[model samples]
Target: MITVELTRFRVSPGLSEALLAARSAMLRDFRADRDGFLDARLVRLADDEWLDIVSWRSSADLAASRAKGGNRPGIRAFFELIGEIVSSEEGTAVEEAV
Candidate 1:
């Protein structure tokens, strides 16, 4: 199992609602599709920043989804918005050892 952490930042004001709406739509899409995803969570950080933690069965699933255009519209829009704001992304190795 793998997890993907996607974060986005909004600027200029009043963009957070639009971005979050998009996120909600995208989450619905993920829920409808069961093969390519394990689970996903949309999180809000601060007024203009958000994070999406996605769990996948494998990297191949992730790649295949992107290749087949399985990502979300809001996600794409968020990236487009990033070009207008300051944003960064980081992938981490999660250890579930307890």
Candidate 2:
């Protein structure tokens, strides 16, 4: 299993709402994909920062999803709106819970 953590830094104060809206659209679109995407969460911090965490069955599934490009229109608009506000960084890690 793998977890992807995306960090975004926002430029303006009110941009968080827009980011959430974009994420909502993404959830609506990408929730149906196979390959054990599992689940995701969008977390808001401070005035203009967010952490988007996604769980996948494996690294291979994550790569395939990236290659497919999901939903282009919503995604493009989402990126365009929040791109400047966010400097994205991603990583994968093991999740262990006892």
Q: List the residue pairs that clash in candidate 1.
A: none
Candidate lDDT (C-alpha), each? 0.58, 0.63
**Top TM-score: which candidate number?**
2
Q: Write the per-residue lDDT of candidate 2 for residues 1-98, one digit (tens) a residue.
A: 46564646553666666766777667655666546577777777776666667777677777777776745655555555553435554567655647
Which residue runs does candidate 2 get wrong by more than 4 Å?
A: 9-11, 84-98
TM-score of 2: 0.66
Candidate 1 per-residue lDDT, tens place, 1-98, comes to: 46464545454567766666666666666666545677666666686666666766776666665564535664456444442434434354477538
RMSD of each: 3.9, 3.1
Poorly placed runs, candidate 1 (over 4 Å): 70-98
Angstrom error at residue 28, model 1: 1.5
- The estimated TM-scores of all candidates read 0.58, 0.66
